[model samples]
Target: MYKPRINNKFHKHQIMMEDPCLAEFIPETRLFTNNNLIDLLNKYKKVIVKPSRGSLGKGIVVITELGTEEYELLQLNKQKHINGLENVYKYLKKLENFNIPNIVQYYIPLAKVYDRPMDLRYIAQRTEQDWTITGKYARVAKVGYALTNFEHGSSILTVEDALKSSTIKNFNIKELNEKLNMVTLSITTCLSRYFPNHKIWGCDLCVDEKGSIWIIEVNSSPQIKGFLELESLLPMYQSIVGYKTLNKKKGRRSR
Candidate 1:
């Protein structure tokens, strides 16, 4: 049997983990299991367990420790407060209906806006010979949501607007953008080396209350309809078309 390369969350995470420097930006992630859930919840007090191959924030659950032997599970946009570690596992299993491949990551207290969570999405695409960042925007999660997925009622905001309203103290927009770009590019470069055929990436990142940046996820197939609505993104669309044209030309020459 021949298997195709799938860009699942765990696979991409492993690829990034190969590099020590890049690994630092990644949160502590592991295969979601009964034991893993108990340990991570106790460690992080607030951990996120999401589908390994799911998108649009579907099937994502947020688990928070209320106290010893007590926890709160957030899923399906609702909160269920439960007691005991074993009960947490049973509740999740019931909600899932069976075992599903998922990843459990230590939740970082991301910078917020007006008490709403938010994250930055870096749109990087490959040109003729190199990777370039074409767009950057912030997704302010809907009130009381754990994920900032655009499909889930999240609003798109300019990076400046997000930073201006950010809860991170002494936030520097200029410095943050610089660091974000550098890390986004680095991730694309590393992933490209492994999956050379893929050229576009949408990297989701966040800044903690302490001003430390963390990579939440790297989306290989990012939705662009929301971005296309902005007239300012015209140049980026052109660049993408240009890259397609250039690649076509090279393909002809090779033949």
Candidate 2:
């Protein structure tokens, strides 16, 4: 059996930064280190440290500035309060497995619904001629959880429903929807330029309270069933089949 994948955060970030359009949306990310952590904390005041190759939001740490010489670190459902930068670095190092490389990302204050952080997932797939967005939905984190992943008990919401339920005031629904579509397509196009073999992607994105959008990650071989049901995915299924059929025909003609 053959497999295709891109799980390295550094490699993916480097590829994305090459596209000028995407570089702005991606938050500052760096390899985890004692100095990097302290410097990032002093600059952004809050940063997230996570393993480079991890899924379902595992082993992620959210560090926040509490006050002078005091910081709070949140992992999964637990929070640890520590004082001073040296202590913070030592604590994180002891908790992490040194064998696995880790990355630190600027934590975006994502929009929320009912006080719980929420994000969106957009699916794009290759059509006969080009790529098109299939569908999108909002994922709200369970109360007190740090991640909005399905495995973490997140609740799925329609775009309209999420806006309606949120405390955000004076928001333009149409404008938000248009922005999401444009960004999702742009991301699909840019990534496809480098990795042409993959035809489908599950893009994890988020919007801040100021309506600024960010591309959190792009998942190849995403878990489609999270939002796509058997009936809803028929068109996508057909599109993939059509693409493969054309490729097979072309291969035979060349031989």
Candidate 3:
């Protein structure tokens, strides 16, 4: 029986790891061993441990400062923890023993919309000679969830709505768009230098209290599900690939 091979989800991360600047966009990650976990908690006093290749917001935990002595631990899709360090470590160790490949990321206090965390997902594509913004959507974390992934029952809204909401005070929609576009272009341009042929990309970014944008993650194969008028997107993708093929043929003939 022939079996289908699994695609490595970390392939994109490996590529990003090759470039120092790109790697900085990735979260601070480490294997979940006892020593590593202890060190993480001690250094940051608050950290998040998640699956390395996880998606959809499963198996995530948020650690926050309660006081000098106490800590709060909240599990993704679960109740909050207001307990001591001993209990928290026990709970996390149990999760670690479950054979899940986990990493601890420095928790970024994201800007909020409606008392909920908000993040930007920018869809980007490369044309024959230029990289362009295809679309951008804001992912808002559902009540009581740590991450703003759709699988965790989060809601999706346009970037426009997020900026206009009262929760996002001091928000400027036009300026946000400009900043997001600039970051997307910068990331795509840097990646293109290494993989000149790769064209499509999706970037996850977060804005902190000071309105500075920080890249959270990068996705190579972006899901176009729920995008409006995807029929319009098909032609753009066709033209990009079509032009590349035509150029390759012309080069061969000239040679």
Candidate 4:
């Protein structure tokens, strides 16, 4: 009888940051502060503001460059102008009051499907030898929506369907799967070195216009309820519990 384990996103992030394989994919995330926000805006004319530990794509803002002296903020499906540099600071301060950790990210203009932003959720599991990809779902941001999360009204589509509609269609299905698996494997291998006991992860990936994959975010304790129909889903569920049971038995033996 195996019991599953839950992973904490913050703890995993701290561990992943130390991993050589994942270090490059990890962004230079900083705690949200008026000064930091201003610095980010100055460095990149366009940046993304998002909750550090948020799920389902809630509380995301995309600030874009209007001109050398002007900028626009797209927050929660609404766009507004930041009158001046000082306003950027003020807006960040207001967000801080919510008592949530937020970070400024370099915006990656993700490729679109059906005129909506598209991203991939790579579900992975650890086996006796290595981490293996169990499933991959394509998430398409709803029309006019800022976030491409199912909870944000986005629709779920097969990766094949998504790639068909993408502007970059040079990649065949086999190539795409291989590319995704390689990236996910690299990231998990690195993260596991620091937290060897953990078992599951969901890597959020985006493809740019050039057909290159960029890691948007890494999620621990990924939601698997929606993937029950996937061929690997059952094995993943069993492996989770089986690993926990084996770990407990080993602890007892050591004692």
Candidate 5:
């Protein structure tokens, strides 16, 4: 039997947009083209160009407007300055993955913890009837970086710990926590409609400087070692282990 999982980022975005309730969590994403990149940049001033099928934060580019007719491109934690939008487009197009499908999306000004960007991973597993949030944890990027991958010098923390020190100012922690749960649950529920046999989902999400949550992407197979390594996440981590044990009895598997 085939795995009931989707890896194409563009397709996942299309389905997430279908739900009216998810409109706030979905960003403006378009296929990567010089024209599309120009248009997105014109509107958002900052955008991300990433491989549609890539993961682990590899081959992702963050483009920011530096000044009039000037742009900065950041990749793998290093950045360069380009003189004009045309030049920026040309540089990106010369990359090896340029000819293949990629996506250009609005660059979220992520809520920061001590000037380092932070985002979360929420794991939801299907029970007999509905999806349950099994586990979650936040990733804080190393100072002066864009992507938040644990393997790329990021540090993991409980969501509360990271946000408490955020520059977002005084806010209700409980309410903000609920929003994260709701967004991930809604995303998993929406994705299951397309891949019904899929029993688990790992959704990546981030909060903007405005405190609004954005669903980054859904993973069919998320890395588990991050959860296992964190002492503060022991409870949620055990929940995932329990879910795995239960799934084994039912012959459910993942890829």
Candidate 6:
């Protein structure tokens, strides 16, 4: 039975990095240190600084290199243009949530639809037997915003619509689903070995313009409200509800 949700992003990243199959899907991530922040930025040019235990996109800052000695530190839609490394640290430390433990990661250049970035939420759940890919949807960022969580959504589209309309011009939908399913299952199975009680994960993932899939993060306690919004997912939502019930009943008997 699910006991408590896992909310530490860095810890989860370390756990998943142990599996060879899941490593490539994960972006370069590390605990936020002044050195790590600078190193990742220098290597990736564009990096994301986020709270280790944040959600709904709060406390996430996307830093992009605009030119020599010029950087853009974006939080929500407000962009702060800066001119030096000293000022970069100053600007970030001024944010209200600056004290929270944070992580720095190489930001994946996600595929965009209509000039707004988008990513897919892949949900996998388990039963008495094995994990299954149960729900998926494309979350488009609000125009001019960097974060695309439900709180910052422009609209939710079927994965098909997102892939075809976005900059990715070529894909066989059958082949794409197969790859997504295989990767998602591998992730859930690998995670289950460490977090035995968790039975569901909502992973935020994206495909770059080059068509490589990257796992943004794995959510241990994924919500179903977004799945409820899509009519086609009603049955899947019901099954999730049923699974939670079964877990609760089984937990009672064990206790």
Q: Which candidate tops lDDT?
A: 5
Model 2 lDDT per residue over 22-50, tens place: 88889988989988998898899999998
Q: How far out, in Å, is residue 160 in model 3?
A: 2.1
Off by over 4 Å in 1: 1-4, 97-99, 229-255
Q: How accurate is candidate 5 locally (lDDT)?
A: 0.86
How high is each candidate's TM-score? 0.90, 0.85, 0.72, 0.78, 0.92, 0.93
- Give one digit per residue, the lDDT tens place, for model 1 in 106-173: 99898898788889888888775588887787888888787788898887777778888889888677
Q: Per-residue lDDT tens digits of candidate 4, residues 1-255? A: 222223334445555566676666655555666677778778767788777666766677888778765788876567888777677667756763346667777787778988888888887776566676766777888788667877766767667777778876576667876877887898788777665766777888877777777777778767655444455445655655575576567668978
Query: 26-82 in candidate 6: lDDT tens per residue?
Result: 999998877887898899999999988878888999999888879999988989899
**How many clashes does the backbone of model 4 have?**
0
Number of the top TM-score candidate: 6
Q: In model 6, which runs have C-alpha deviations exceeding 4 angstroms?
A: 1-5
Candidate lDDT scores, in order, read 0.81, 0.80, 0.67, 0.70, 0.86, 0.84
Better of 1 and 3 by lDDT: 1
Candidate 6 lDDT at 152 equals 66
lDDT-better candidate, 3 vs 5: 5
Q: List the residue pairs that clash in candidate 5.
A: none
Q: Write the per-residue lDDT of candidate 5 for residues 1-255, one digit (tens) a residue.
A: 233339888888888887987877888999898899999999999999998887888779999998899999999779899998989988988888776788999988889887898998989998776899988888999977898988888888888888887766567889999988988888887887888877788899988777788888888888877886687788888888888788877774553
TM-score, model 5 to reference: 0.92
Over 4 Å off, model 4: 1-28, 96-98, 225-255
